[model samples]
Target: MAIIFEEKQNIFHLQANDTSYVMQIIRDGYLSHLYWGRKINQYNHSNKLQFVDRAFSGNPYPSIDRTFSLDTLPQEYPGYGNTDYRNPAYQLQLDNGTTVTDLRYKSHVIYKGKPALEGLPAVYAEDKNEAETLEITLEDQIADISVLLTYTVYEQRNVITRTAKIINTGSASVDLKRALSVNIDFRDADFDFLHLPGAWGRERHIERQPLRSGIQSVESRRGASSHQHNPFVALLRKGTNEDNGEVFGLNLVYSGNFLAQAEVDQFNNTRVSLGINPFDFNWKLNPGESFQCPEAVMVYSHEGLGGMSRTFHDLYRTRLCRGTFRDKERPILINNWEATYFDFNADKIEQIAKAGKELGIELFVLDDGWFGKRDDDTSSLGDWFVDKGKLPSGLEDLVNRVRNMDMEFGLWFEPEMISVNSDLYRKHPDWCLHVPNRTRSESRNQLVLDFSRKDVCDEMIKMVSDILASCPITYVKWDMNRHMTEIGSAILPPDQQRETAHRYMLGLYRVMDEITAAFPHVLFESCSGGGGRFDPGILYYMPQTWTSDNTDAISRLKIQYGTSLVYPISSMGSHVSDIPNHQVHRYTSLDIRGDAAMSGNLGYELDLSKLTEKEKEVVKKQVSTYKEIRKLIQFGDFYRLISPFENNEAAWAFINKDKDEAIVFYFRLLSEANSPFESFKVKGLDPLKSYKVENTNDIYGGDELEFVGLSVPTELNGDFQSHVWRLKALK
Candidate 1:
């Protein structure tokens, strides 16, 4: 059984494959967290909450017991303004203007399968026996409000997902000041806080620090899970590394404004909370209406950060991402964004596609400026029709030109944006999100569409659908270039003005769900500038995301490495672009670039026709090699050997699930004079099996390769150099 309820002790223990989460109903029916870590046969109730008489710790039941205070208990979903001064998991304001809520255990139900979150993206169980869910109801009698906390545990993965539903069971409406998804308390604050923080182009860089006395957090208030901070955080025990110790990771499956925080109290206990950012946010729950927060995924790993990452990779790659392309090997495509940008004609696009087909590329993507007289970024965003001047033969003619070359075709669309110069904008001036009489700020000469309005979403769906249905487009690069500004929905009421951001997210999801469902054969890749909206929410509709706009090989070493902490390799759209690279203007070797991009879904963003004959040969070889190993790279278990953040070198490997094949990639950013000899050690290999190294007569036991490690080539010299090794078991 994945979940066990000890009735007498009132303890609820949820067990994943190798981890466990235990909580119990304590004094006065308060739900408190007990333990979360390595799995055990049974929780002995040894980690019980301690009742103490502390000064200034307000107690609701002071007359019954002065020592029993909610302030000291390690609560599962803590309430605000009821003595616990730490940040709350949720908050509510009654019609009488009091911001106090006391939630006590009411009832609970355990089920075999996990239920889906209404209108939200979440990890799901395909089979009933694959997971179990426990829904516990906590209610405040005075406010007539009930908070239902849901926990789902995967039977074979070290993952547990949490969500909360706030229901107003009274006649009066209540304002939800804060409705965070999940919260947990730890007994001590001796852990290191780890998060991914970076700016645009250089996204998801790893940052770690020791937990201080105050609150430390990573959040995105830019109306997106912005490139500034990813919606994920982890607590690592002291001395933990990639392959050892313990870690607790929490990732929010949301793309809008969010917050992930860890607060260390004076007593040294740590409280971790994750959910929607309460900044400029509130939800009005009317009678019989309930609001569901986005799901928060929690992963516990005793085998270190690598184990935690692998658990996330496996779960997300299979369960979280859905579509025709989810399990399939991604195509080797060439995107013409960098090759042609906004300066391409139909003939120029075909020339690049022709060069790509000759070099073994399987797909050709025609990027921005193909539609609606859009010669540059300043105009024609929402008008999805083809520009007659650029594509005189129409979009179908261009798609057919590429399809006739035995290669698939794809197109790029900034569906969530509108230019002031667009015909669509001229037709419906109120389509863009803005307050009346306010200056609508524009980024890249585009304004965000008011997706909170269903009419606007329906029009977008129709426009995009018409194009997809009119051609043989097999892939789409759905791009959103800017963040929200002047975020007000004209259709919403004054009381719900703050609901614009979240409502827009919901509308975007609805559009994606409808469009993707209509065209199941199409492979959709999400982008926000690049990697700006790269969160689990978008991954649910689109299998992969353009990892970043910065394709510099040396730069990607850190970007991709940090991204792998939570996202799977299959979910990252990595491509090799020309150098002096477009984003950073740093020159790196083509071989090095190919090596970096090959670690994920391999593609190219450079003009294939511009490469010399020798470079063409190298590109051909890279394509062939990726095809040979793409299955393993996409579906294998990944391990991080060295980090680019901490070392001058970065090393990672992928081993198939059957343990018969493995691939290792080692990179050196800059060469050293007279450097010490090094061997790249790898994990997840079968020790007893003998394997043959590809391209060599070398045969060795897996034990020898894993323990003794592989020797790094001494002749490798220069900045931004890399090496790859392939191993196949000698059956």
Candidate 2:
């Protein structure tokens, strides 16, 4: 059984494939964390961690028994008023202006299937037996609040998902200060802190440091998951790398401001927490109301960091992302963003569409200039109407023309943004989020819509859905170009002003849920400038996102590499752009650009008609090659053969489900005259089988590929050089 409750010992044993997690109810109804890591069946509940009394610390229930203390125990859900100083998972502020909460385990129930979070996005079990869940309810009797800690174990994916739901049943309203999704306690600080942090251009770079005394945390306060800190953190043993050592990964399925923290206690024990950032957050839970926190996934890998990453990959790709395109091949698309920018008309778009059709492109996306008078970034954002000046016949006519050219059509919409000069803004200025009389900051000449209001969100859904229904558009690029500023909503009270950003996200999810349900066949891709909103929360609605605006091949090697640490390659929207590459202006060969872009959802973001005949031929070959290997790239098990963060050469490989075929992609940034040749070895293959290289019919045993290594040509000493090798195993 994936979930086993040892009733005799009052212990809960949760197993997810190769991992096991155990917790038990101790003296005075205090729930304590026992063991997590590896698959073990035995857990001596009586032999718990020693609880020592300490000064200025929370004493365990029944003050007479001075031996047990909450401050020294490894509690699963410690509260603030309990006197436990090591960061409480939640805090309650009563209506009388008192901040105190003491919660104890009330009851728990084991179930066969997972339960859905009321108003949140979570990983669901497609089948009844694929996962099991345990719901432990804790109550603060004095505060009249109940917290449900949910744990879901996937039987075959080595994944454990957790969520928290807080119910307010008191007479007066209560304010929830902190309600973290997951809080875990480790026995000792024998690990390192691993996080992904960077700025606007360079995002999600890998960083590892020693576990210090104070708290180490990663957070985003920009009303987004932000380009700064991704909502993921891992604890790794010293010297742990991709191939070896124990690692524990925790990821929050949320896209707003989030916090992931770790603190080493006085006794060297580590307590890590992840969920909504409580800095500028306060949710008002009135009587008979409940607040559901976002889901956080936990994965343990004894094999190494690679195993940890692969576990996240499998669960997110197959279980979290939904819709028709979840398991299907994404169409090869060409966007006119870099080609014309804001200077293109319907005729220019039609010209590009015709050219792309000739080059065998599957889709043509009209990026930003077709709607309103959006010739520049300054005006007409909320007006979703198509400008007849750009396309005299309107949007449906262009969609029909693109369909006539034997290609699917896609349109872009920034529904969450409003322009001061637009018709919608002129009519309903208060609809945008802002503080009264406070100067609202704008990025790219736009303000964020107050999605906290249902009327505004509903209007957006109607406008976009009507356009999609009337046109033959099969894809929608939903975008939010700026972050929220002066985030006070006009409709919310001053006391609830801090809840605007989170409410906006909830409204956005509701809008997406309705529209995607209405147009089930359409593929939706989310974007924020580019990769700003690329997080698991948004991935629930859209299967893919634009990875970045920096299409430079050299820069992409790192951006895409870092994104793949938690996100799957399929979710990244990458494309080959024209050189003197737009963002960095670094020139590279056409094949090199395609090789880098093909690592993601294959696409082109340049004008096909203006390309030289040779470049067009190169594109034709690139599209064909992607179609040939996309099955393996999209659904295969990926292994990082070389780390871009650690090595100069970026290399990775993928193998099919049955392991009969494999392909390796390698890139060389620059070559030196005297550097020695380096050979790369492959992993996760049948060693006894004989494999044949596709380009050359030479055969070798799989053992040679793993042990003796695959020969890479070291003589191609040039800038931006790359290679792609394919192998098939003979049965």
Model 1 / residue 202 / CA error / Å = 0.6
205-252, model 1: which lDDT tens digit per residue?
999999999899988888899999999999999999998999999999
Q: State the TM-score for model 2.
A: 0.98
Alpha-carbon runs more than 4 Å astray in model 1: none
Q: What local distance difference test score does each model get?
A: 0.93, 0.87
Worst 10 residues of 2 by lDDT: 54-63
Best by lDDT: 1
The candidate maximizing TM-score is 1
Q: Candidate 2, after superposition: displacement of residue 553 in Å?
A: 1.3
